[model samples]
Target: MKNFNIRSLMIFILFFSLKISAQNSYINQYKTIATELSQEFGIPTVVILSIAYMETGGGTSSACKVLNNHFGMTGRNNVNSSRFKNFTDSKASYRAFCEWVSKRKFYEKLKGSQDHNDWFVAIASSGYSTKPVEWKQKLNLVMKKIGL
Candidate 1:
């Protein structure tokens, strides 16, 4: 029993380490684009990164893979449709996200703000997610996990 417990613990540790490593790699891959968007759009970098990470599942979501829609953004006149906005590339997707956010009414108020809570609240209130509360909760978890 003791040996089994030790092996299980080792396996768990290995899995956790791998998850963290993958997350770090994902962040590194997109951090530059996120940073640039934040600077240009006045959105917090952490907010942008956390939302992208959660929405795309670290860029593994079908929307990200197929549509290059990193933020789960739906196409115009297709909000109720399954179709998402297709981008030329991941950077284009990121830029589109920033453009969408910049148009939000709360953008001017929360612009350049580092407060994730406020940003999440504003975003959720803006109909960004069908399940706003749950979405914010998950975003919080992603932000925490990413150490942002």
Candidate 2:
């Protein structure tokens, strides 16, 4: 009985620590996503990650889980996504978001090009925000706390 109790407590503590670590991992994951976006779109990973964290709470969010949505994107896509089965993961959701973003007319400006500043200007000038005024500021606040 004593051995079993001690082992159970150790397992509980180990599980708790792992959970906290995964929570912290989001900042790094968000940073990675930001870096990838900047390299491809001329937007800094900080800014992009900030936006994603605001939009999806670093992708551990209920919105992403319930809706498979990463960026709060909504529309009628021409991508022939009529089949709605086998959506088993967030990677699929993020891929869909990327495809949708890629298909935008303004995104075409990025084709065969490499200009970071210009890409950011395009993102801002394109009026992509339906809730812009507060999202970025809120993301910045969270980013500061995470040491990003």
Q: Pick the candidate with the highest TM-score.
A: 1
Candidate 1, residue 143: lDDT: 91
Q: For residues 102-139, what per-residue lDDT tens digits would candidate 1 score against the true structure?
A: 89999999898888899999999898988889999999
Model 2 CA lDDT for position 93: 50
Q: What is the TM-score of each predicted model, taking all chains together?
A: 0.89, 0.51
Give lDDT per model, in order.
0.89, 0.57
Which ten residues in a row are the worst by lDDT in model 1?
75-84
As a TM-score, model 2 comes out at 0.51
* Whole-structure CA lDDT of model 1: 0.89
Tens-place lDDT digits, model 2, residues 1-148: 9999999999999998876576467766556554565576544555555555656766676555565556666654334353222234555555554555566676766744544344445554556564444544565576675545
Which segments of candidate 1 are over 4 A away from where they belong? 1-3, 76-82
Error of 1 at 4 (Å): 3.4
Question: 126 in model 2: Cα distance from truth in Å?
Answer: 4.2
lDDT of 1 at 12: 100
